[model samples]
Target: MAASTKNVSVGTVETRGIEPVPDSERHGHAGQMFWTWFAANISILGLPLGATLVAFRGLNIWQAALVAIVGSFGSFALVGALSLAGKKGGAPALTLSRAVFGQRGNAGPTLVTWLSRVGWETITTTTAAYALLALLGVAFDVRQNSFLTVLCLLVFIACTLLISGLGHATIMWINKWATVLFGVLNLIVMGFLVATVDWSKVLEAPAGPSSGVIAGIGFIAAGTGIGWANAGADYARYLPRTIPGRRLVTASAFGAGIPLVLLISLGSLLTAGDPSLATSSDPVSAINAMLPSWMAIPYLIAAFGGLLMSNHLSTYSAGLTMITLGLRVPRAWAVVIDIVLMFLGGIYFMLIADDFYGPFSTFLTLLAVPISAWIGVIAVDMLRGRDYDPDALMDTSRTSRYWYTGGFRLPAVLAWVAAIVSGLLFTTAGTGADDVWFSGPLADTWPGVNGLGWAVSIGVGAAVYAVFGGRGPITTPASSPALEESVR
Candidate 1:
């Protein structure tokens, strides 16, 4: 068998082993790329779906709107800020870790990101299965069970394999079209609500001030934006610096954050009529009841399309992260492996995730600290005014800063460890009917809101890394590679 020859670069750093894609090989220009990002990132429909079901049942439209607005704006600002930090710190994310944890240190965060992909893949598969079950229930009055779950799993795995097998370019192409279809469906639902809904009902206040409204907002924001945070660079890495990547910060932010809130709001309004249905686990069920039977077919098709789009993205990002970790596998092969794992993991969840809310919530809680730490370090690196030479950032050569100290960076390592510990505390703290440790009013009601885990993780990780990790000098190259520096 012939060896695959695709070059593997670490983060954005430049080096010899890696080769830049020819213009023909590159995906598209900036506008095209932006839309691709918009579509790819929006696959997070499950995030808002989960949030609406679990967090704010009685919230009036005003409150729902407010929550959506805050969540969207916060995510946009944070993701943009973190991306800017990565730009400043010279691939401060996946690559910069080399300076702290060693070349092997990169493995720690990569593993975290990879695990996050798996979590998302699992969650998405479950949600897709759940949504299909809801449709079945609506049609035939059948109940959800492990059998339906397994059937959905088979469908999801099949779709993932089919789409991903076509390659990255094919995925990008599908994303553009899916986004258009999704946009039309979004317009349809919102249009219906505006046309039919009683504004007075939507404007009324909820039953009472929800216990974890603020904290609930936090978890919702985290779930919605976490995937974007981990893979922001997957798109940005290809951005031409002349285009001013900062604007991308804004575009990327609004592209994702605004639409998410609107979707949640739409779900809220659509479910407002049947108060009991508002809290239903399946988002489709909650909203589908609002529309006429004629609308169901198109809406279901759109919803299923949206589900597949997002699921494909999770698998795609998982493939990229796996490759970054030096998996030495073709992307096609990596995606296949990812689909297999997602199918198997999803089956496990179907049988024993216990409560939909419980395991899903626990999964996010476990992830909160480490992911926060990773984002925090990158943000701090930007704040410190670290210089990012694009060529150097993508280089895989041994002489670059990434390869200095035998490919390990201590500051990144320490920061990661601290973040993990903080996350553990935040997840495990507090008990039922008692303040565990640092349990606040929010934690008393909302299971996931107790410890302010996200804040602690970001603050501690950033503070520790900024104060201690900033002193290292950029290593200069010695043995010269006889080639012109390739630009992205």
Candidate 2:
């Protein structure tokens, strides 16, 4: 068991694929969650997000800072609150979908989480590739090429993939050490940026165009805030039962929230000071320009480490998501599939993706709607009660309790679909600044109405589900003992 005050060494007796983190094995303070989720999010990818807010969204540095603070805090707070469920039921977040969606019904949310996390892994990989490419270009004078860039991609992703294939305990340990090192490096780098920046420009920079501020709000508040929602419980499943739910939530929120606000603000600060940095072709190199030569390489390395933290965590959760899809495979093997998919996607983006930032940003924004609604449903379920059967989560038979009308929970699915449709119709997201426009009828008239479609999606879904009695579904039991041993 974990010591009450600190994490104790559980040493190498890792559980099998998708098994509940048994009480004997559960040993860690809730505070460890702070490092887990926090470390997962502290990356240079956030820099571009901040830049988009100031340079593209028309927010001043101070306004961007305010948005980052509020958005990140609320987002991470949701992440942390969800962590309580992990310890309550020793299963991954995706696995827990069985409670909301039936055993067969769970496939819907599982697919969404799986696809989104895979997308996130792709981003993490692309960001790392960018960093390594920049580092190689500067160090060995090797500029962009499909072969050399892919080589860096494979090498860097491979290292993190190996760790990902190892699964949760290993992931948490890596995040702990990584957060300490990268956290310090990022702070020092920010200090440098702060010392060099001219605050006069930061304060004077005007907003981008019409609906810019709202778009920025949507990007940071919803887009960046809830990216980790599906995976929050993945890291928290191992926390000891002794830890209070309040601590779990607090540790998780602060762990992820603080660095996000700080780093995102620094990006805003940089872009506000020099508008040119926003348009720079190479993001890592752009930031590297501000640092001293001695510290530049180390910062890149730290940024790469941050990428691994987010990438492998996504990989790990993607594996759980696959298992949640009722796939009969070892969790490590699921991770292998995730790696292969990520590697393939990474190759495509590096080779053929013409507009990288535009597509990536859009890709990130696309999932926020579904994820927000899904989290809303989950948070509602969590608030109702702590009761859950960890073993039943993998139950896939017709008799499983989660099996509603033809293996789907009608209300939850309908709510989710309705919310997603509304979001898609109303959301003002597109390829570039000039082309970006809201599609909904409401937005058509207002013109300046761009952001917060996610709220409508999630709110409507949650409200519908509640009114329709999502919790009223009848329960049943599985008949196959062997099936219980295998993943759903």
Candidate 3:
């Protein structure tokens, strides 16, 4: 058993603020935490629904499955590493960042956390709007236009407020119900398609192999893992200290990684027949093609409910990030703000933001580099046995080890910058001599470079910091209100 609360206090001075809850109250048995994390991590569906439409383009079922597997690993490995590291260190996200960035320097990672929530919210809202319209087409005939999109945006805004206001407990409650509905709907769609589509056609390989199979896998991994990579600590924090780190890793990996590969691969198979599925990118359309028109009612209801469940995640996560950053205001207020902003972002993307998805895809790719850096640095810190207290991450007190030379570690920052630039280069440029000579070498060799950016960013940061900045031994803050926190 872990130490009692009386012994765990920061000092003998026990002024009663919301002093961190004790280990017993905070860290319950692993089973409860496992289910909670599982519920949160299951939201990976939203990503593939919007993202895989672009990635699996023109690929057969086998090819798409292979690609999704690769992608699922990206998320799996990163989260597995983080969860294990955190368990050993006994701290969570912001506190972990303090080890590398210094107590004062933790703001950098926090900013990234905020941006991710905003970006995710925008993407979720925009994509959900698109699907909502498609489902509506099954019942009331309406063309895709600014007016129709506005209506969808209104609905998203309203639901976002509800979910965010409810906080983590309510969101998890909704997720349990939503998961049931999603599983049923997906089964029906996949079952119908399996029965309807000529298996022979889906089994056939593409006339030519994908030029960027590895890249496709990396893309899938990044998308699948993105949620957990940033927020692993959010759920890990709730885990019983008695649970071994290895067990947590296994639970998180199976709960998140395995299912995503299956779901995304199914989506790829779902779209294998229709070359123009992107233009007609509605799940309802996907089912309609599989079954009779009337059958779509049940499927649509299930899908719409699932979409709401997924939307609850973006809103909830966004509120958590905002509150952790210094919104001492009511949780309800934070959610209201997020919903309003998400609504505006939705309208902006549909009405003003042309190429909403193209850039969004690139943005997601680019983010992998920096977020990967944060993960790498923390992993290195833990492995090396440096200070690892989560509560002390931002403490400016003299005993704080996180305040390194000048309160900022140059090595980690440099490594992060390099990773970000590398991701950008690949996202913007294509690989090849022609791309190099005509458009430039960076452009030519970049686009084809699948998971290279993630590998490079994560690897380079870890290597550089390990070799050069390894000398610093510092105590991380146990808890800092200013440091960013992730949602599980």
Candidate 4:
């Protein structure tokens, strides 16, 4: 039965869920990380992020490019580091997080992570649907009515559900091959777009203040790699323990970093010429308008394919997270539930929402705080040489090693909550002062004004956990020969 369950292969549904992957099933090299991350990030979403830096943050093209490089590369490096926990423990990230946050206590971060994944999946789905709509419009002269809109969304969601429901092996396979196919198509389209850029206007744009650059970095990081930080281990959990931690980190960073920098720089340049792209409601159609008539079809195709790649990965992680949150269903069923929600979200965004960038930017800003806090706690635990006891991770009762103090790890929970509060105190999310959703008391402070709330959250979470985490009885690895020998 164990062997049958471990039979994960390309084109087959991966049966594993939040459970730790047994040693016998572990197979892969660090290099795969590059393709996984690269495929996830090749979507045109990064373009608007760059545009926002120039349009809203008042950054020049050069400054926006610099922010992209630093923010994307640095954040994914942290993702790679967190992935080490997955490799060591041989479990999904939140599953391994049980060791750090305790069984019941883990629910808070797990819930937040699940919500983040769902939010991103919905955004990706909506964006891809728009791409498909644009493609149909350009290719066959189909107009986007309500019926066509729903149809496009269903098509994208169905594709995501199929890939994500197949789980890990299938996602990895598609990541490699689809990345190659779409990467070439996107580059061709990008070449055409680049040729059309207004160079004089791009060069004449004045540089913004240093403060804008700082905010741009924060926005880029939050939008790009920070969103994926928690899900790093969901993909990496299948790798063998022998892989060096640094190698994994390097692969993830560069895999995601390479395309992001180029796309962001292009976005900045394009926005420098026409700032309207930054505030466009439908980025897919907006970008398509700039492409030559001949290139529009392929450009939209690339956009659709790229967003599909990203959505599937996010959906896959969201499924695992849902299971981790105690959802009583098979992994595939959880994916189905998530897809249903995503479908609804797509409908709302396409039919009801007044604006796209406003809600998206606010979502990123608000969610970045709790996610960063979780990262801080997990990073500290990983650095402390924590090893997950697989059996204990599954055992949710008082007998479990992870059931720290009435099923709550107070230190970690306290740290996470405190960090979230502190971070929110600095977070101000809205289009402007009049339209603010919620602004913290410290919203006028430099960190608040500059959008460094996520950074502040991480620091506070780590600092608080470091001080109080040792107060309780320290968890030790279960004394099992299989586990012992594996570590050695």
Ranking by TM-score: 4, 2, 3, 1
- How many backbone clashes are present in model 3? 21
Task: Write one digit per residue (lDDT tens) for candidate 2, span 13-125.
Answer: 23356656666777778778888878877888778778878877778876787778777877787887776667767678877777776776677778988989888888778
Q: Write down the lDDT of every candidate, Cα atoms only.
A: 0.59, 0.73, 0.56, 0.89
Q: Residue by residue across 14-124, what tens digits does model 4's lDDT show?
A: 878788887788998999899999999999998898888888899888899899999999989888888887887888888888888889999999999999998998899
Superposed by TM-score, candidate 4 places the C-alpha of residue 190 at a distance from the truth, in angstroms, of: 0.8
Candidate 4 regions exceeding 4 Å error are: 1-4, 471-488
Per-residue error for 14 in candidate 2, Å, reads 4.3
Estimate candidate 1's alpha-carbon lDDT, on a 0 to 1 scale. Answer: 0.59
For candidate 1, lDDT tens digit of each residue in 16-87?
Answer: 111223222233434444454456444425334433533444456656666676766577556655554333
Q: What is the lDDT of residue 284 in candidate 4?
A: 87
Winner by lDDT between candidate 3 and candidate 1:
1
Provide the TM-score for each candidate, comma-separated.
Answer: 0.78, 0.89, 0.79, 0.97
Cα displacement (angstroms), candidate 2, residue 161, comes to 1.4
Taking every candidate in turn, the Cα RMSD to the unseen true structure, in Å, is: 6.0, 5.6, 6.9, 2.2
| Predicted structure 1, TM vs. truth | 0.78
Candidate 1: residue 384 Cα off by (Å): 4.2
Residue 41 in candidate 4, Cα distance off native in Å: 0.4
Maximum-TM-score candidate: 4
TM-score of 4: 0.97
Name the candidate, 1 or 3, with the larger TM-score value: 3
